[model samples]
Each structure stands twice: as structure tokens, then as C-alpha cells.
Target chain A: EIADAAEALLGAGGVKVGGALRGRHVLVTSGPTHEPIDPVRYIANRSSGKQGHAIAAAAAAAGARVTLVSGPVNLPDPAGIAVHHVETARDMLAAVEAALPADAAVFAAAVADWRVAAEAGQKLKKDGNALAPLALTENPDILAGIARRAEGRPRLVVGFAAETQNVVAHAQAKLARKGCDWIVANDVSRDGGHQSGIPGGVMGADSNAVHLVSAAGVEHWPTASKAEIAQRLVARIAVALGPQESQS
Target chain B: EIADAAEALLGAGGVKVGGALRGRHVLVTSGPTHEPIDPVRYIANRSSGKQGHAIAAAAAAAGARVTLVSGPVNLPDPAGIAVHHVETARDMLAAVEAALPADAAVFAAAVADWRVAAEAGQKLKKDGNALAPLALTENPDILAGIARRAEGRPRLVVGFAAETQNVVAHAQAKLARKGCDWIVANDVSRDGGHQSGIPGGVMGADSNAVHLVSAAGVEHWPTASKAEIAQRLVARIAVALGPQESQS
Candidate 1:
């Protein structure tokens, strides 16, 4: 319906009063994907799904019709969002593909870059000291695939770069490599290099320090609650996408 | 307070009514522990903490004072219980150590068997073709540690055996190796080898099929919700612990 295409285009980059994201469809992904080693055991990242869930909630609060694709997490489904639960990276890709054709998409999931090339139907035995070696294979680059879509691509796509050392540098490279319009980069190291007393990085932590990277340049933000970061990010997205048209 | 010590010792080892666990103290661990590779990335298992949380809830419902030491999960704290959140297996071990002195303890967490010997203080770069190799070291065996404690160990310690093949045999071996009183063994393989039409044996599923392997023998249970399994387990524990003496 190209909902709010005009108002959004005209409004300056900021939170608009008239339900900035009203009538717009937004897709978001959160949590960590499990790449199976065997049916019972899987390799995974340490993502608690908090930040992505918060972002989905913020987008919904901003009046967007949100579709949240989540990996295995203990969290309850967020109110006012269509949630698709999945386990593996392939499942997440399929779910994302199915939920597409939206105004915007957010890729916040920590999908494993690789999966066991061939999973064992049965559990591998501990047979002696040397465990069975797992063969690796690359998973689909979901962000790049979506960004480089020839048709039906989202108007705006945001990807996250959770790096420790060269946070901004890696995020910049990821923006180019992944072909996404915006990158939300954050340092997730726990060496306490940031301002003392502020818990900057690490998963499941309530707070974050993020940078909004785009062709316009990098906008570093102060350490804040994950909920607050989500709100501000949603605000930026609303400003870029503009306000929604009247509801049917 | 030798609560329920007599009846528990004499009961036929099953669920009994009348708040059999009243005034009893029980401790439990749930979820998968993360082993850091670098500051930002980690190796982890695909555990949703559902079973562990359900067990904690069930114990509380049976009138026991429960202390749940959990790894990173998004679940709301269970009512009427104390919760200690942790991240890594080491952190989990520490938390469990600090939460000792209970009538019983349940080790339901998927503790990592190995951790990167040394964590990268800074973000490890994805340089060139090969990423840095992850040198792993053995993690502390929380269940075995508590089970074989020199003093003040819980009287009825329980451990979980998430195995794929020879589930009962492996569980029996673990019971002996870990020196725990009981072992809740379950097949986590996904080969669909179980009775047809039933979804069984895997992580992240809402339901479970488990075997309670104790010194007495193995008790095979029907497939049931995680909550139901927790309830039945607590019942057995109560019966094992017997009836409590009158409170002060």
C-alpha cells in the first residue's frame, strides 16, 4: 500500500507525532541460531535475545505492524507483534523469506557463520579421548541476500555488527559487505575498556553502547538501557521511513 | 530441622500429596552455559531453560524453598523462589557453590564441557583465511563436585544425562561417576527412533520423555510437558525425603 510514503518522505528525520510507523510493516530478527552437530546438541552463540526483542517492541510501540523472527529463547512473545519461532540458521532464513515484502527489516540475530557440514542423526559417542571432528560449512548470508535482492526488497534494511576491537571499523566494512542501509555496531568485549562503572558490552546485560553507522557517517551513542537504545533506533527508522498513511 | 526425614525414607518412591516438600530446601540449575572464544563471540549449547525453570516451579509448588541458579535466559523469575543468574560454566559453578546447604539439588543445566583456555581480551579479528584456533580446557563438573563434596553436600543430589544412545546405560554410568543419588536421563537425539507420531527427544521442545535412574533402578516415564515432568520429579524427591517435622 506504500503506506505513509508521502508524509514519511516529507517529514524531517525525527519522531513524528502521527504514529510515525503507523500502517507500515516492519520485519525484525533476534536471538542466536543453532547449527546442529547432532540431533540433540547444536553449536550456538551466546545471544539472550534481549536487544532484538526490545527493538521489536519499540517498533511496535511506534505503530508499526512488526513481524519478529526469533531463534530459540525463553522469552514470551512480545505483545502486538507477529512472532515466528525457529531454531537453525536455515529455519531463520526460510522464516525471514516468508515474512518479507516489508517497509523495513532489522537483522539483529547472531546467526552462526558456519554449521556442521553434515549432522549426525545419532549422538556422536565420546569414544576415547579424541571426540569426533565436526566438518564445517558456511551458512547463507541473510543480510547480504536480503539487501541485494533484485525485487521486493525492503525500503530500508538495518544490520547489527557486534564486534569487540575495531567496532566502528568492522561495522563500516559490514555495511559495505552486507549491502545493508544502516549498521548498528556495538562492542561486546568485557575487558572493561569503556568508561569505568558503565557496563558496556556482554550478552544479557541490561545496557548498551551503540553506534548508528550509515553512508551519512557514524553516530556514536552513550551507554543506555537496551530499551532506551531500541526506542531511539526506532525513532531514527521512523524519521527515515516517514509517518504512516491513514488506517483502512 | 530433620523435616520429612522419616516418611521420605520409608515411602515407595513416588509422588505423594499433602505438601510433602513443605519447609524443605531445594536448589536447581537450568539453561546452557556460554564458553567465551573472544570478548564478543562464544561457544554455547541450544538450551531454552524451559525444563530447568519448570523443575524449579514444580518444587516451589510442592511447598519447597527453591533456589534456582540459572544461566542467561529471558524467563521471568519464578514466584516464591530465589534466583541466581550466571553466564559461563565457571560462573555457574561459583553460583552453585555459593548456593549450597540444601536438602536436595538438581543439576539440569547444560554446562559446557570445555571453554576456550584463555579468552581474547579484545575482539578476535577475522583476518585472512583462517581465524585463530580455539584452545579448550575442561570446565568444572558442577554436579560431580557437589555430589562428591567432603561436607555439607545436599542429601539427595540429582544430575541430568542428556544422551543420544544407550540413554539408560549412560545415565547409570553418570550416576556412578558423578556420585549423585539420582540421574534424570533422557534421549536428546532426533532420529525419530521413538514411537511414531510422537515428537520426542530434542532440546527447545515444550514436552519431554525422561528416565529417572536411581540406585533402586530406572523408571521410564511417558512423554509429557516439561512442567509435568518437573512435577513428577519433585514428587519423587518429596517421597524420597519423607514428611517434614512440625515447623517452629
Candidate 2:
């Protein structure tokens, strides 16, 4: 059913499955975390969870046990996946931690780096007086925390870098900083329009042009539908993990 | 078709239209204005635009020529209404100004009071250094700008106050401060849950318990579906504006 839905969404002939990740556990995070300033307002990123959700769907299609931790998104829960819906960065981190001990983990969520230091208990009133600057506090870095873990770490930890400039350089730096095995970098700038010519850039766009950066080298993948990108990435993950005993 | 869709969403037997507003012009603003932090990040309110859209649909059903200037919302354009889509408060204000000289205007949009003073051209990097406090500048008060206008003011200007505390008092103050004729106040606090046993608070919820605050007095309305509330409010608007030759 999940494969069928993915195929339908990504057009026909999408989501090829060979049971490459059979008997393996894969964890995925997607969408933008909302850092609340008050009851009604929050700071958010532009992630639509298309890539991450597609990745999860692909993993599931490959016969992997997939646990998807998602932030608030408009997309429906993909069939045949253990999905956990979360709101804030802290919540997302907790959810990710709870779903750990996977063969691979993908951090595609556009998590907010800073949240309002002091979230108001009530809705903040905008009186005639000049409004005060919202104090800032750093949120828990899920990718760094998980990747740097000494125990029960995923064999392959893939982080995403949605950059506006120096795409590969940023991804390389992010790979080192976050201690992740691979970084999927995508330029989300207005000028970085995908080959499909979809408007509004890659954050929420269907098609993506991504560079898979690892310790060995960077592989610049052509712009393709998010579902196709997911399939390719999952195939690479399967290759990196080698043939599992269950698959054999 | 507009009436049918509204009825379907609001459930069957909804949308009571008496054609009281026939030959009249009704302007409405809906949804939450997104203040950009950068290309990929933004500040947003939790408004679902359900109420405002319902009001617009109700007005259209009442045989009024309706203009809806809306911000970012996950809703289809209501049939039989001239819909103008916008993003930020500035854009919404501009759209509202362009759609002027109406018999009644409903300002239901949760416009951001402030925006980043200096929006970054690129995505702000989260280097190891301590982040700088975001500077915010006041946004143009759309309701006040139109309500207090010396020329071309809508005959009846209605402002909506989504408050967590002092709902009626805040609305009363807002009515005088903005020079709007009426204020529709809704308590959006976590504790101020609607009479309907539905889960989340009013911002994105289906049911609403609203207060109609005018110079005459306050009318506390029972918790009802947003569509029903819209119908009731439109009916009152038609009454307030008096009967027209077309209606007669």
C-alpha cells in the first residue's frame, strides 16, 4: 500500500524495491520544528517533509522496519511505517532518541537552531508600546547528538544540509561538525531552481538536486523527484551496509 | 457550488443565506501573515483561516460581491469570491487597500505585529559563536489603517481579537484604539477551550465560542461550528447595514 501510494504520488514506475534493507531497522526525521514564542505563534522552517517521508517510504518498500519521527506537516502518514508526530525541536529529539538503535538514521528535518528563551504562558499582547526583542536559546542538535553517540549508534548516519550558498562546502563542514557519515546537500536559494523548474525552491518543492558528501568524496546527483532521490539514497545505504544475513 | 462546499465542510444543512447582503460589497482578510526570518525560515501564527474563510463563504452565499485578501493558509479558494493571496503583513495590507470601498470589512487575519528589522539575504549560519538577538520592527496595522481612514473607509469595519486573557476587555480597548465599529473576540488560551469537546484550542479548531463587541454592548455567543458563527455574524452585518434596494 505504501509503495502504491508513493508510486501514485511520484507518478507511475517509482519506488523500486529489491528487499535490499530486509530485516534492517531505519529511523527517519522530517518536517520543520516549531519553536513556540507563545501559545499561538512560533518560528518555523520551510521543510515540507517530502524528501524525508519519501526516504521512509522507500526504506519501507525495501522491506525495512522504518520508524519515522515527523514534525507538523501537511502530508499524511505513509502506510506501513511506525510514525511519531512531534512539534518542537526538543520533542523531535526525544522522539528520535526513543526510535534509536537503527541500521541507518536520516535527519532531514529543518529544525530551528534557536527557540524563544522564555516562551510566554499566554498569548503575547501587542500594545501600543514598543515590543521587546525575543530572547534566544539554542535547541538540542539532534543530528550531532545521535551521530556522536558512543553506544548503539546507527551504522550509517545521514544528515541533510539545505544551504543557500557554498552547498558542498557547507555539507562537508556539516558532515564533520555533526559527526555524520554522509551529508545530502541541496541548495534551496531562489536562484537554485531545480531541473524540473518547480517554483519556490527545494525546501517544499517536489524535485531536488542533491550532493551526497562522504569521507571518500561528493557525488552530485541530478535534480529528480524526491521519491527518486530517496530510492537512490536507500540503495546507497544498502550497498554501504553490505548484504544482510536475512537478505542472503 | 460555493454554498455547497461550505455546507460540506461545515457539515450538511449549514450556510443559511437570506440574500440580505445582495448588491453589497463585503471584504475580508483571512489566515496568518508569515514574517520572514530568511528564505527558508519564518515567524507564523497558528491560524487555520477556517473562520475567516467561512465568513467569506457566508458573505458570498448572502449574494454579496466578496473580496478576500488572505495570507498563507492551507485552504482552497472559496468559489464565487475574488480571492487575493498574500504572504506577509505588508502584502496583506497592500492587497486589502487594493480591494477597498466595501459595505463591510472583516479583519480576521492574525497579522504579525513585528517582522525582522533586517532580513538576511541568505540563510543565517549557526556558527559556534553566540547568536545575535533578532531585531524586530513594527508592522503596519492593517485594521487600524483601513478603519481610521478619513476617506474610502468601509462602512462597517470589524476586527477580530484572538486573546488568551481579558477577551472582552482587550476587544473593547481594541475597538476604540483601532476605530473599528465592532470586534469579534475569541479566547484562544489553552484553558479557554471551546464548549465543544474537540482537542486543540480555537486558532485551528473547527468550533468557536466568540464575543461580538460593539459600542452598543457585548454579545457572548455559544460554542458553535465556525461556519454557523460566520452565518450568524453575516446575518447581523446585513441587519447593521440595513436593507438595500436589491434586497427589497
Candidate 3:
């Protein structure tokens, strides 16, 4: 019945109101990727997958078929969404590749930027003074990877800019670098009320503030709850996917 | 004694390590602003204030005397930071104005884009099929306000972009619209995995992934906790705020 309704909506679409994203496929990445430094010591970030989990749930609620390629996190799978779990950034990228031909892709996972070039099977003991420096290398940028895809690329590829100072300037540069459809720029500076502690913890102790930057222009939204922000953002997406008549 | 050491470090040109921001003044805004629909119903967003609050704490830790102007939300104030509370977007703007004349400003608050033109003191009754249409007006862009300030303007002004689609394109436009030094862009769409159902909470979350965009180029960071992101951002700010740096 839902499929039939979606087909009907798509067949005669003048201005879709009830179901804007009935046939869209959305790809999202979540949680933290672990980069192994040694047997015990690994590079990772603090992410509990709360934000990513909530985003998947919200997308499902908005009638989108979501494929959430997640990193290692202990959050229950959101109902009505397909889940693909991975551990490292490379695995997450592969999972994203498997879920290709999506209508939209959201690179939300906190991937490790660098990984130890050599992984010691055994944990290294602390040296007295002359400790060997661990050589590192850059990791693949999943957002850029998807954004720069030549085949089966999603129509909309989004990136995130977690900055401290000159937030807008950084976001502008990222827009060009990643070639994504949009960038959600945020100041993660400890002094700006962002996450400043360990990962894999809870979040949203206070309210939030954000700006929406797009080709149309920059629209600033005042402070509110993350849930409220999601609803407003979903509504905006609905409009963006709406027919020409509905836009005006 | 610490002040004298700081002066000595400045004199010796060795303060650039971690104490580069020793005496800078920073103004930050966080949380959601409410737009009253009635006494009971108001327009708002889902923001936990985690990101903003974290930024404030990080900036303070980085040696900046920070002033946090926030909208209504439940969260303990960070140590060594001055906080001002407000309710509506208008009030937040006023608070920001009152706390001005700082070296830098970060508009991280998720302000409402529109507000009811006039508040109806009494809640309207839902009697029948007929309902009153709400009339909304655009709110002021607080970041833009500070960026365009003529007198006692902050040397650096940063804004945020929370987008779902066309992220980079939108961020670039926002850079122009807000006239800010930088914009931090992120994708917070439902499938972006950065939204939580909880109204306003921020803690115990895992890693975060973000990009740093600037005139020079985009630098993408792998996912980590909000704290790590804050630390890196503060370090970047120290470099940006250093002497005779090229303006991007």
C-alpha cells in the first residue's frame, strides 16, 4: 500500500506535500573510526553515535530509505532503516561504495585522519626517555571521495566543517575542496559550547545554534533543540525536493 | 606571577607555542532562540548547546577571556568563563551587542530565522476546520551584525553553516552574506547522523568528523570527540590570530 501510494505520488506530482522523499535513497555514515597504533593503543575519537542514530531515525520518519554505514558505537539500530556496521575508516568507505547509486549521501562519521603506518602486534612498553615516534599517514576523505565520484554518484553529497575560528571562511574553502552539495559548518571550539570532552558519550546538554548555507544563500537559524533542528531541516529538504510550483 | 611569565613570553616571542591567545577577548553565542507563537507554543529548534558550550570551554582553556552569550537551555556554566542568558533571538542579539568589543566573535547559536510578527497574548482556540495562518518576519543575522559592525567591531567574526544539501555552495554564499571571517559547515540532515531525539542534551557522545575550510583550502579532519576537535580548532585559532599571518 505504501509503495502504491508512493507510485501514485510520483506518477502525478504537481506539488508533493505529504511525501516528498518517498522514493529517495539516502546514505549516511556514523560513529568513530579506529586507527590502530599498536595492539592496545589506537587512535580514535569520542562518538557515541547519538547524533548519527537520531539522524537515521529522523530520515526514516521522513519517508526516506536510509542505509546507515556506521563505525564502532554502542547505539541501537534505528527502526525502519538498514544498518551496515564497520570498524575503521577504510571499511566505512567500502560500505559506502557498496551502497552506491543513492540519491543523497551524508558523510557524518568521525573518521580518523591519520593512522599509524606500522601496527605493532604487541603493545609497546613505555621507553624511559628515547621513545620512538610513531610514523603516520593521512586517511582517505570519505566526503571528498563520494563527492568526487565519477560513476553512480549521489546527486547530493554533503560534508561537515567542525571549526573554531573563521567558521564561514573555512566552510567556504571546504565547499570547494570536497565538492559536496552542502557543508554543515560548526565551531567545535571548547569555548563555544560544543563537544570538548571524550567521545562515545552523550550530547546536547544545552540548546544549539546553526546556519544553513546553500546556493540560494545563507539562512541563519536561531538557537533551539537538536530535535527541533531536525524537524526544520527535514521540512527544508521536503521543500527542496518539492516541485517548482511549491517553491514559490 | 602568571601574568609576568606571559609578558616575558611575549617579550621573548616564545608565547606562540600554546599560550598564543593569552590576553585575547572572545565572544561566543550558543543555544536556540525561541520565537513565540503564543504563551504556550513557540518556534524553536533541537539544539543541545553541546557544540557551543564546548567551544566556550575550549576557548577559555586556550587563554582567551571568553564571554558566552546563550539562549535558554539547561546546562552548567563552564569554569573561567562569563555567561549571559537570554530567551528569544532578539534578546540574544542584544546580549551579543552588550558583550561586544572583543578581539573575536563566534556566532554558534542556532537562532530562529523567523518570528511571529506579533504575539497573541491569548492562545487561540481550535474550534473548527478554519485556522488562523501565522505571519512570520525575518530575524536579524547576529553574526552578520557583528561582522558588519562599524565601531568597536571584533577583529575576527565566525559563523556556522548547518546544511543538508549543497553544503559548500551554501557556505560560500554565507561567507558573503554574513561577511564573517569563516564559516563552519556541517551536514545535519536526517541521514547525516548528527541529530539526537532528545530535546536538549550533550554528553557521553562518541567521535565527530569535521572539515576546516578557509581561503587557502579545505582541511578535513577525521572523526574524533568534540573535545579533540575543539583543541585542534583552538590551536588553529592561535595560528590565525598570530602576528602577520596571511589573510585568507
Candidate 4:
């Protein structure tokens, strides 16, 4: 049933999948994590999951045995991929760790930076005194943890830096700090508002213009459909792995 | 294509929709609002939009002309409903206001309480210094705004109280403060962790146990699937509207 839906969506969208990463295991994370505030509410991010889902679908098309650890997204599961759906960031990390031994990994989900430090088990409500103050706590750095894995880490650990300003600089620092091999950065800034003549860039938008920042330097990729970007990125990963490494 | 997927999901789940609310213009809000921090990141609440979406579907099934003003969610658009998808709380409020003169309204979205006071046009990056500090500003109170509308207010204004403890007390206060006709309060507290003993109630779960609180009194409903809860709620709303008001 899931495959049928994927096939229909792909056919309707005219998406192409290839076999560049064939015989290799590739992992992808997509969407937004919901950090629980109470049973009813949580801290989350606005991640359309388009780019990451596109990447996962593209990777699968390229013949990699793909395991997509996805956050809550509305998209139909991509064809020929094993998908693990999780709600919270903690749950997402656990799922990722369980699906290791991959040739490459992509960190694409818009994970919340922080959660309520001390969560109230009961629903927090107004008492006419004043609005409640929320204490903050940082979430686990999933990309950093995977990149710095002591053993059994994927050969290529890719991270994403979603920025509005100084894209390359932040990507470089993130690449260094997260200890990831490559960083995919895109400009998400709005000069004024989205109504300021320019289109909505990166994040929730359909088309993306990205810059690839690596230890070697920066390479700019032209604006293209998310599917195109994924296919290209997967092909690049395939090249990095080489024939011997990618083959089962 | 969206309808096809939704049909498949509904068929698989065996969800039932009816026409108790025929001809009534019922507006519903669902999901979590994204408050922009930068272009890529946002401050959001943890709302899966399941309960609200279920309600929208239920109202539509019952023959109501439903308009769902939704935030970003992965769930498929409810079949046969007009869905206005927005990202931020302000946008959501605008959408809600535009759909005015509704016969009934359900404020179910877990709107973010605050937004970044100063939005940055550029992507915020760490500059070999301390982490950036976020200044918060309050978000528009959609429920209150609608409930307190000077004119063209929906006959039945419903709000939700997702509480952990003292459910009734908080909901009563919210009812008084928000000036809504009724409030649906639910206890989302898990006795232990999600894996401990009992399953996580409400939130992202398929089943929900809730309390319908109003000026009359508190009525506890037993645990049921989200669909079942929605259908029952819509039926109750129909009765409240009475015979002359509901029919087209």
C-alpha cells in the first residue's frame, strides 16, 4: 500500500530515481521533531520535509539500501525505502543509532535547539497571576554525535546548515564543529519580508540554491528542483565512496 | 492525487464520517504555528494537528461546510474541506479572520505563545562567541480574538485546554478568560515514560481521552480513537446548534 502511494506520487510529480549509491546502505533524516511540553503541546520547528524526503527518495532510486529515519511528516513514504517514523528528537536519535553501519548519512531534519529544561508532567495553565516562564535546555546534537562516532560511523557524514546570513562561514564552522565530512548550506534570509519581490528561499520552499562547503573549499550549486538537488547530492556521495566502497 | 491518498488512508483506517453539521460554516484551526527565528529556524509548539484535523474531517463528514485553517503538518489534507495552510501565528490569525461569519468555530491549533521579538533577515551564526540570546514577543491569541469578536461571532465558540493537572480548574479559567462558550480539556500526563506501563495519550496518538468543560459543568469522555472523539464532538455541536440552525 505504501509503495503504491509512493509510486503514484512519484509518477504524478515525474520524479526520477537512479542507482548511483547502489549496493550501499544510506541513512537519511527528514522533517521536524516535536519536543513534548505536555501530552497536548510541544516545541517544534517548521520543516516541510521536502528536501530531506527528496534526498531519501533519490538515494533509494540510486540503488542504495536506504533507511529513512523520519520525523513526523505528511509525505507518503518513499518507494523502496525502510522508513522509521518518530515524534521527539530523543526518539529520532535512538532510531538513527539503531540503523547504523551505513556508507553515508544525511542530517536534514529541522531539530528544535531546545526543550523545556524541566517539563511539567501535568498541563501547565494560566492562573491569572502571570504567564508561566519556560526554562530552556539544549537538545542532543544528533549530527555531531554521528560524525564523531568512535566506531562504525558511516564513511561520509553529511550535515546541513540552514542559514539566512553568512552561509559559507556558518557551514564551515558547522563542518568543523560537528566534525562532519561535508556541509550543505543554503541562504534562508529575507531582505525584507517574503513579500519583498524575492522568492521564499531554502527551508519550506520547493526550489533551492545551495552551496557545498567541504574541507577542500566551497562549490555553488545552481537553483534547482529539490529532486534534482537530491539526485546530484547522491551522485556526489557515490563518487566520494568510489566503485569499490559503494559495491556490496 | 491528494484525495486519492486520503481515500486510501481513510479506507485502510476504516474512519467513518457523517452529516450532523450540514450547511453550517464551521471553521477549525490545527497544528503548530512556526515563529521565525531566522529564515530556516522557528519557535513552535508541539501540536501534531491530529485532533483538530480529525474534528475538521468529522464536521465535513457531517455535512458542514468546513474550512480548516491549518499550520504546517505532514498529514494529508482532509478530503472535501477548504484548507488554508499558514506557517506563523499571525498568518493563522489572518486566515481565521478572513473566514469569519462562521456558524461555529473550533480553536484547536497549538499556537506558539511567543515569537522572536527581533527577527533577523540574515541567518544567525555563532561568531566564535557565546550562543545568541532570543528575545520573545507574544503571539496573537486567535481563540480569544475570535471568541471576543464584537460582531459576526460564531454562535458556538470552542477552545481546548491541554492540561496535565487540575484540568477542570485551568479549563474553567481559560473559558472565562478567553470568553469561549465551551472548552475541551484533556489530561496528557503519562504516569511514566511513553514506554512505561501506559501508552502516551492525545498528542500524536491515535486514541484520546478528553473532558468537555463548559459553563454548565464537566463531562468526561472515555478513551477512544481520534476519529471517534471527533465524530462525537461534532454530534454534540449539532445538538447545541439545534434543528433550525444546522440544516442548510
Q: TM-scores for all candidates?
A: 0.76, 0.92, 0.45, 0.77
In order, the B-chain TM-scores come to 0.88, 0.90, 0.83, 0.87
TM-score of chain A of each: 0.88, 0.91, 0.81, 0.87
lDDT of 4 by residue, B97-166 (tens): 9999899999989887777787666554444321434556678899999999899899999998776667
Scored against the true structure, residue B1 in model 3 reaches a CA lDDT of 38
How far does residue A37 in candidate 4 sit from its true spot (Å)? 3.9
Query: How do the residues A111-144 of candidate 3 rate in per-residue lDDT, one tens digit apiece?
Result: 7665656766433433241144445566788888
lDDT of 2 by residue, B47-136 (tens): 999999999999999889999998889899999899999989999999998988899999999999889888887888888533777788
Give the B-chain TM-score of model 2.
Answer: 0.90
DockQ order of candidates, top first: 2, 1, 4, 3
What i-RMS does every model get? 3.9, 2.1, 24.6, 3.8
Can you tell me the CAPRI class of model 4? acceptable
Superposed on all Cα atoms, model 4 deviates from the true structure by an RMSD in Å of: 8.3
Q: List runs of model 2 lying over 4 Å from the truth.
A: A1-15, A128-130, A195-200, B1-15, B128-130, B195-200, B246-248
How do the residues A192-232 of candidate 4 rate in per-residue lDDT, one tens digit apiece? 22324332355567777888889988888767888878876
lDDT of 1 by residue, A1-248 (tens): 22244335324542343367888888999998877666545667767788999989988887888999999775889997999999888999999999989999999998877777777766554446424334567788899999999998999999998876778988999999989999999887655335443222457677778998998888887787888788778777787786556666
Off by over 4 Å in 4: A1-23, A79-100, A128-133, A148-153, A190-200, A245-248, B1-25, B54-67, B75-82, B126-135, B149-152, B191-200, B222-228, B243-248
Residues A91-204, model 2: lDDT tens digits: 999999999889999998989999999888878877643388777889999999999999989999999998989999999999999999999999988888553433238767
Highest lDDT, which number? 2
Candidate 3's TM-score = 0.45
Descending-TM-score candidate ranking: 2, 4, 1, 3
Query: Which candidate has the top score in DockQ?
Result: 2
